[model samples]
Each structure stands twice: as C-alpha cells, then as structure tokens.
Target: MGASKIGSYPCEEIVVDIVVQKSEKIFGELDVPPSKLYTQFATALALLAEGKSTLKQPLRTKDTLAILRAVENMGATVKRTQEQLSIWGVGRSLRPTGNVIDVKNSATGIAMMTAIAALSPRVSVITGDAQLRARPMPHLLKVLNNMGLKAYSTKPDDSPPLVVLGGDVRGGRISVRGMNPSLIPALLIPCPYAKKKVEFLSCGDSLQLNLALDVMKAANVKVSVGKKLSIPNQPYRPFNLRVPSDLSAAAPFVVAAVLTDSKLKLNGTDLASDRGAVLLNILKKIDVKVEVSNKFVLVRGPQQPRGTKLDLSLTPELLPIVAVLAAMAKGRTTISGASEARTMKSDRISAIAHGLRKMGVKISERKDGLIVEGQAKIKGGEVDGCNDHAVVAALVTAGLFADDKTIVRNRAEALQTSYSRFISAFQELGAHVGYAE
Candidate 1:
C-alpha cells in the first residue's frame, strides 16, 4: 500500500444525522470542554477490552462512536460509570463474528477497525460511507501488509470495502512519511501484537508525530524516536485516557469573536496546541487584539481585522475558520502551502469560498490556496455544508454577523466530526438561531 493521487469532487449535500439531545444550561460561559476525537475512540476500544479502563472527558463524536461500535462488534462490552467509561477488554485473541462491519464515515473508525481486524483470525470486511471510502487508507494497509497481514481493498483504486484476513502478525519496522501524516498512528495501532519491533520514521509532521507518540504511550508500546524510532515487544496494555478539547473546533468561535466588536473568552482549551498558537500568530499578524491567561484565551474583535498572507500547511485544520476570519478582514488575505489540506476530507477553503460567494463575499480560488478580499458589509443568503463539518461551522460563524438571516443547509452535519453542541453554544452566546425540522 502506497499513497496514490486521487481526485475528489465537491460534495453537494451535508447531512447531519444527529438527534439533538435535550438542551442544557450553559455553565456560566465556560471555555468549551476538550473534545479529542481519536482519544475518545481509542478510549472506547480500551474500555471494551478485558480490563478496567478509565477515559477522562471523552469526546462524544461520530467517529468515536464508530470506533466503539467496531469494538462492540468484536465482543467487548463498555460501560460508563460516574464520569469515566469502564472498558472490559476481550483480550487480543477475540475475533469478530460479523461478516460486514461498517465503520460509517469515520476515518479513525476505518483505520482502527481495520487494525483491530488484523488481530483476529476471523476474516472481516470493513467499509464506510462514500466520504470515508474516498479518504485514503493505503497507508494503514501498507503498514499492515508489511507486518505480514493480508489486507486488500475490494476495489481497484484502493478505496474502502477492505477485506482483512486476520492471522499472526510478524511485526517489523516500517517507514512512514507523507503529505497526510495522520495515517502514521493509524498504522501503529495494531503493531503491539507483532512478535517483532516496529519503528516509525516521522517525516517531520508534528501533529502526526505527536499522535504517534500519544498512541504508543497510551498502548504502553515502548517507542523510541529521535531521527529514528524503535518499538520493543510488549503486551498490549489498556490505558485511561483524557481526551483534550479540539482547538480546531474552537477556531471558528475564536475567529468569530475576533471579527466581532466584542471581547470573547473561551475557557477549557489549550493555547499550547500548535494549531492554536499558529492561529494566534495569524491574528497578531492581522492586528487582531488578543490576551492569553493561564486558563483561558480572550480575543477582542478589532474594529476591522487586517489581512495578510499565510502558509498554513503545518496547521491546515484551521484553514476554514481562518478563511472565515479573512472574509471579515480589512485587506486581501492569501492562504498558500495548503494544497494538501484537501486530504482532510474537507475542501475547507473551497467550501468556504463557495458558501461565502453566495453571500456576496469576494472569494477566489488560487492554484494552491485561496484569496479572500474582505468587504465592509456582507449580505446573508442560503449556504450549504457540502458534507464537511468544518465548512458547516465556518458558515455558521460567518452567518453570525451577516446583515440578514443566513440559512445553512445541513448545518447540523458538523456534529459528525466535532463540535456536537455548536447550535446550543451559539444560542447561549445570544445568537438568534433555530433549526427547522
């Protein structure tokens, strides 16, 4: 399995398949809670295994549930007691009895489920929705194939419908580096059961490297990294993980506050996140007022934000939110070095441009990035989410200041990836928002 060039189309409909839970009172303008998607899924899987597992502040997102569903299908039971989820591991010898295990639209689910499938003697086929299937899985497949696991795509282009023939894993070192680095950790999840050592050579993607470290540390897989790394043979250990809040999810709110004429404070976030800090720097460059405290970050909307050029390749996840901020800025903003940003399953730059253009914002697509020329005022119009959660959030954020009502079709779709409680949060912040059944 190797990385291949694939073309993707702009999606038309963004369907949000969430039954909004009962609305609860806002706990006094607190910074939103941490919502780590990967950690939540991993925690659920750990809880389903044969052990006492503790997950702290788990993020309840679609991808996380998809992973938990996979674990449940594999004969593991999970229980939530008090504030923590208790997972009873079914051990490594457990096999999934099902024939078709659908992972839905979750990338983490596809990756982890496929990895879990490799551990069992049962032949399992992992599939997902069209969007998830469009996402690349060759990186994980390549790693598994390297470890002597018989894994193949049911289709010619190496898309989903992955048929994994489970067997004994002969672990070996594999080199992973690429534009989409998230696949690195996905490849490592199944390596603990390997009889040999597994080494990962990070190609300088910080997020991917960090995720790999987190995964290795959580599974208690002895991993050593420097220019190179080694994983020692070890028994798979279940971990009690506390999922961190998603800074990516909070970016829109942060940008919205920056664009408005109010001082907004977001609590329960890590300013230390690479993406968070990068956004802060971008704000500073654009002359947005910001103050950071020990526990929270406060952003004051500039009378008008000054736009500038940025290469957001390292922090591509923030592109959509940042683009929204640019849409409200005082100059031309250019985002480059983000051609690879499309790999995240959301063509955020293009999506924002598409939705905003309908709202009378001047947006143009560059070969590798986007250009947004801010206007003094923007009129609201109907926008579509296009099946991208980040795009939905961006549209909602943009709509907040629009002169008229900006109806976002399928706006609720954002819950699938992150920010499940966005509508309520917006309402709590005094925005007049409602959903139409």
Candidate 2:
C-alpha cells in the first residue's frame, strides 16, 4: 500500500528516516513510561479534587503533556519538577479558561479532558491536531446529554473539535455494551461529580476496564465493578501515587531483545498489576525466557522464536510490534480480535502489514488482525511509519532483525507522541539506529 496524504499529516514536512541495521547483539536497561492512561486519569482526577495531589514518575510524553496543559487550562494549579508533579485541584468548582483546549496528537488526552471540561457549567471546545482529529470519538454524546451536558462533534464522522455545553450533571444509568472499553475512563472520571449517583446498567470486560477501576480506587472514589457497576455522588480525593511503567511502551525493546537473542532489563514496572501480564504470557508461549522481580523484568531472546496464535482484542496497541516478532519467528503466527486497530490514529493493522511485507515478510492483513508466515531473516527495505508511533517503533524493531539496513520514513515525529526516547534508547542498547542524512 502506498502512503497517502492522510498518512503523512503534519509530520510530512518533518521527513526523517529512522535508520536501523541488523544487530548481532542488542542489550540494555531502559525506563519505560508509567502507564499513559494512568498518568492521564490521575491528572483528570487531580483536577477534580479539592486538595493538592502529588504524582511521582508519571510519563511526560507529548500526549500526557497535552493532558497536563488541558488540566492547567481548566483552572488547576500545576507545579512541576524533574521527577514529580504537584497539582492543586479546584474540586467541583472548575473554571474554564474561555479558550479552546487543543490536545494535539493525543486521543486519550482529548477523551479524558472532554469529560473534565464537561464538569464546568459553561461552554468548552476541545480540538486536536490533524491526526488526532481523524481518530474516532466515543459515542458519549447521548449519554452526556442524558446526564445534563450537551456534547456534540463538529464533524459528521464524530472526529474531534468537540463542543460541550456542560455543567453539574444529573447522573443516570448508562450501558457500556457498544462503547470502546479503552474509553470507559472518560465516563467513569466524571461520574463522582454528577448530582446523582451514576449507574452502569451493563459493563463489558477489558484490561482498560480493570485499569479504570484501579484508578478510581486510588483516587478514593467509591466504585463497584460487577456485572453492573455504580459510582456514587462524591468528591474525587487528592492522591499520592507512583505511577506504574507502561508495558506498551516497553514492548518494542522486549521484542528487540527477543529478535536479537540478547538479554535486556526493563525498569520501573510491576507485572503483578500491569496490563503487560498478558504480553508476558504471550512471550512465554512463544518460547522467550522471562524473569520477574518486584521492580524490573528481565528478558532473554531465543535463538529462534516459536510462532503461536495471539488474541489482542483488549490490547491493540501491542499488535504492531508483536506482528514484527511473529515475522521473525520460526513458523506461522496468527493474530486475531483486534478490530480496534482500525479506529486508531492510523489503521495500524494495514500500516504494519504493508511495512513488513515491504521488508520481504509474507503477511496477509485482516479486517481486525493478521496472518504472518515467519521467516528466518527478511530482506531490509524502506517502509513508511504512516504517522503512527507504534507502527514507527515496530518498523524500527523489524529493521534490527532484517538482512541489511532498513529505513523507516515519515512520521518519526510520531515517536514523541508516546515514547519520546525510542531512538536514543535503541542506540543505547547498541542497536544501530540513526536519522537518515
């Protein structure tokens, strides 16, 4: 598939190729972002609390920073240092800045911030960059309207530039049957501020659902998540938390170690509660050696990875790199249940498939997933990043295992949207990575 204009976005002019060379050995310890969702949720809750909240070790990527800017725009006092953030929240009395909140490239930022904006009894507009505006918005307008907030999309496709005339909401019953589970926090975060108790008539299961419940727990909000769930009308309490490292951000490095037959360590993550537990199990299933400690995970790559089936219905963000791992494995690998990939900033399934197929891997793209025939080694070639961070990182990782130099062009800027230090980290691990001259 040829890269289209929409695939380039604002990143088209940036035009830098991430150069990677086949590595005989790749090893290092890198600090991954504590969960991006955790950071954004914590910030949103902090904005709703009465007292000051202290968050340690939060991920400071472009996306998370956009959320922080939105929090500040919504009348919260934010103090920052090198390692920690202190936010003095406005409680239920949120003040609007009388300006548009532009979340740039963060889909997560816009969703959480829109809910926060709706808590104020005034008009608020939320917008984003082109790529972010192209991503799908959750079907929450009807639910928000039912709760006394008027929310609508300016675009027919329900893309961003969302307008909300919001205020103190009258909470009512909602159903999560058709809603995207990753966006559940947008609904849950604002429930405590509603005039009445918010009740969820039905709840679907997902890792994000569990993470939302976890975030609610830490913020001292009362939530019960069974077949049906409810959040009582109360105040979100200010919290002190050390955010857990992001497993999705760590995935590329893990796969790099696996593909290179090297040992690597990832710091500041707790597998017992992290969303990466499923990825870890998948790694073991594919015959990778993994050791878990309280604070770090140690991974040893196999000489030849054994291919297996994967279901990424709940964790679509991991699909791109996992697909790369599958391409380098010893046999056929099938990935299913990731229809959500189509709704992201890019159609990640198509993007990754096109990139890998260009590198001489046999891949068939599916509506929701992929079927990849593993090769001992694939040919090095050029691939477009398609203005997606995960796809860029995945292509770079695939480059490490290719037969010669690989060049990933377009949207290298997308890396800053999530993992800001991807190139430096790869270089530190002794992998050959550089900008194309």
Clashes in predicted model 1: 14
What is the TM-score of candidate 1?
Answer: 0.87
lDDT of 1 by residue, 1-437 (tens): 22122111111223543222211111224355455545544653473245666676666656666676777788677786434666777768565768778877777667767777778878989999888787656766776787778889987777898998878678766666652565555666666667777776654656655755665577666677677667676665777776555455577767766665555566654654655666677777777767875456766654577889988876776777778788878889998877766666677667777888887888898766789897536667778776777777777777777767777775456555565666656555544555655
Per-candidate alpha-carbon RMSD to the true structure: 7.8, 5.5
**Highest-lDDT candidate:** 2
- TM-scores of the models, in the given order? 0.87, 0.94
Off by over 4 Å in 1: 1-28, 44-50
Deviation in angstroms for 42 in model 1?
3.2
In candidate 1 the C-alpha lDDT for residue 132 amounts to: 77
- Cα lDDT tens digits, model 2, 175-227, are 66677777777778888878888888657777877777887788888687677
- Model 1 residue 377 CA deviation (Å) reads 2.8
